[model samples]
Target: MAREITGFSNPLVKRVRSLREKKLRKREGLFLAEGLRILTEARELGVLPEMIFLASGADPHPLASALINAVEAAGGDVIFTTPDILGKMSGKDNAQTLIGVYRDRLTPLPALDRARAPIWFVAQAMRDPGNLGTLMRIGDAVGAGGVILVDDCVDPFSVEAVRASMGAIFTQTIAHASWDEFLAWLRAGPGQLIGTSLNTDQDYQAPAYVPPAFLLIGNEARGLPAGYEAACDLLVKIPMLGRADSLNASVAGAVMAYEVLNQLRRTGDQGTAPQAPE
Candidate 1:
């Protein structure tokens, strides 16, 4: 059903607005994604938000119409509101005309399909939402299975992270697990865990990456812990040509991810080399 909302006093408005907070999002099991383009991407990818808020006076576009039709077809609710109320819901004065409230669907570590794609990105103890979003974008770029967060990290579904993902949040699979859980799951599968580290003497480009390579990126300022680095199947380093000690976490991840992606694509990823016939 469609309803027109004239006031910001509605509990739904406040409820969507509070999704920007971690605690509120945790309790509600919902997250807010604002912007017509992002929601359209979701729609095209078959993800319809449970509830949609549209600006009552906004100009119509074909994509927007498509999104509305798709949402309604999926038995989703559509609420028409003023731009001001829309802004309140988005925590922005110049918010987009469209906003979506989606239920958070977290992929548990055990449920992750190891062979969904050739590349997978893993982040540990990451705190920055923008960095987290960039990681998701990288995963989407390389056609990765997903981006997995190891240990405590930023909430990927947060408004900032989702906005920064620029719609890749819907394209890329997002999952979470503790260090122990992730290690056990990866070991039980046919995947290689590769970590980006400064302590390694191996250049990032020198190694042959296995398919389903799990690219591990550490905290922004701290890199990977010594123990975590030791657990990796391989450790490689991006050389520093300038005065900077290292690249940014997301930048480093892109470099490593692309190198492995190119390798896998070029070699056709024959898996581990077979032992020579006896």
Candidate 2:
């Protein structure tokens, strides 16, 4: 049977509310995911929630049922509470009766993985949670290996980010690293590192890309750091037809990702470049 917490002052309610604050989330090593879609996606992503809270008055919508089932299958418990309690716990202007407290997920990249080679997106100092989430979803559509976030990027698990990703959050791998660590990793990489910059002399489509390649997308407003441009093997830019100076970070990232995919397909069509004289 599901447990019931009637009062808004319940201890569990306070614990759940704390997740909304960054300090609390970090201290507890847990975060809250609102709505059924996010919770369901979390389950599919192999993230098991410790507990899920469902609002008493909110009918179990189909999406909610799916999320409840996932939680049950994972041997997790679900709690029921009144709307008043939910509002208190959620701390959102628009409260969703359903909320999940999931285990933190962090996966390390293996050494030069073949399956991912020729496609990777690097987010350097991207601070917007929404933009980060959208980029992850875009990466998924284009069959990207994963996303590498430099140290200054926003928390992928932020509430706004989870909503923006629309469940794509569960499908992508997000690896975080310091700038120095990223530089070292790039140096040992499978392909060259390409960065986007205003001063870039070459067009994005100019190069015939190789597999295991990486395209760097820096901050949307400030662009990439000066030192980073020098570190990259090649600097490239997207051609802008309109008056806008440049595309949004997420748009720029998706464009570059598809470009790499297109080149790979084109290379395949050309047929293996004929084995050299044996």
Candidate 3:
């Protein structure tokens, strides 16, 4: 049985609402995920939220009901609340029927698997949560091993980023490191460090990306810091046909990431090579 929460001052409600603040979320080590799709994806990924809140009288879709039941079976609590209460917690106009409280899932830099062609997207000083989320989704879509956030980047756990990810946040592995730490890791690892730069005349497609490649992108505003290109095994640029100076960080990353996949696929490295003329 789901308990009914009617008051705005409820302790659990307050806690969930507080997650909107990065400081509070960091202190508590938990974040909120709103919407049925995200919650379902999280559940499918074996991520069990600490608590679940469903708006009373909201359409009880079969999947949502099943998720609620599963949570209760697993000793997790489920609360049915008014739409207003849910909206307050979700910080939205009309909140989704299901909102979940989940623990943060950031991981430390893992040992690069030199035996396989693993791709990693490295974002340096990325500040836009929406862009970061989109990048995460792109990373997940292209089967990248993980996303690495360098230095003081925007919080991926923030509501905007998580929501923009459209559930990729649950599936993708996210890592963090400082500039110095990343440099050290790059030297110690067997991966090729690839960077994007306008100064480079090389087309993005020119690189025959090796296994365990790290695609390093810079901040949205200023681009990569000075001398960073020296560390790259290869520097490539997406051709600018229009007047724009550069594509958005997320767009540039997606373009480069897909190219890497395309190269690998054509080369038959991952066993997805095109068929020969029959």
Candidate 4:
């Protein structure tokens, strides 16, 4: 049986509650995972939890049951507490039913050349968690390499972002890097570098895509940084027919990803040479 943990005053509860702050999350190299889908993805990604936190009424939630079974099977620890205590620990109104302590992937940046096989979505200073999550899902959909959270973006592992991702987070390789490091990699990396902007004279569909490209998507409100505009080998813009001006960050990212993937597939299809029979 999972150990029943009572009281919000417990030291473990206090520790879990502290995870709401980014500093604490970074310091501990851990993050919170709420809901069944997120937990399931974490497990499938081979992310063994350090510990599992479940509310008293959590057994009824399908995700909660799955999480308990998964955790127990992995020989991990599960602690049962009250909903009120869970709410206090999670720092969110909707976080009561299910939660977990997961070790952040924090996988070091691999050889950027190795990563070049897949397309990449780089979002700079993106603020909305939902937008970031949606972009991750899109990257997974198009079989892109992964989504890179460059510079001042929201915590990709946040409860909101994880929930918004709909479990797509597990299938994607998410790396956070500084602007200098990211730029350095881009300059030396194997993939073609592409940036998106409203001022670009080039249409999004005008040029044929050459993979392994990094399609840079900027913040919804501010767009790309000043330096990012000049960093790309080419900058392209989506044609906007309406007065609204711009698409959401997620929507823009999805369109660009699909277009690039389409072009790459076409190129691959054409490159396969016919074999002559003896």
What is candidate 2's lDDT per residue for 104-124, written digit by digit as tens?
554565443534444678899
Q: Candidate 3 on 1-278: residue-level lDDT in tens?
A: 47899999999889899999999999999988888888999888788788999988757898898889888888888899988899999888776558988889888765544333367889999999999999988977877766889988999999999998888899777889888888887787677889999888999888799767789989999999867888789999899999988899999999998888777777756422123212
Going through the candidates in the order shown, the clash numbers are 0, 4, 0, 0
Candidate 3: Cα lDDT at 34: 86
Clashing pairs in 3: none
Model 4 whole-model lDDT (C-alpha atoms): 0.76
**Each prediction's TM-score against the native?**
0.94, 0.86, 0.93, 0.86
Better of 1 and 3 by TM-score: 1
Over 4 Å off in model 4, which ranges? 57-66, 91-96, 110-117, 267-278
Question: With candidate 1 superimposed using the best TM-score fit, by how many Å does residue 101's alpha carbon deviate from the native?
Answer: 0.6
Relative to the true structure, candidate 3 reaches a TM of 0.93
Across 127-190, the per-residue lDDT of candidate 1 in tens digits comes to 9999998888887777777799998899999988998889989888788998988898899979
> Comparing 2 and 4 by TM-score, which wins?
2
Candidate 1 TM-score, C-alpha based? 0.94
Stretches > 4 Å off in candidate 1:
270-278
RMSD of each: 4.7, 5.2, 3.1, 4.9
Local distance difference test, each candidate: 0.85, 0.76, 0.84, 0.76
Cα lDDT, model 3, residue 172: 72
Q: After superposition, how far is residue 19 of candidate 4 from its true place, in Å?
A: 1.1
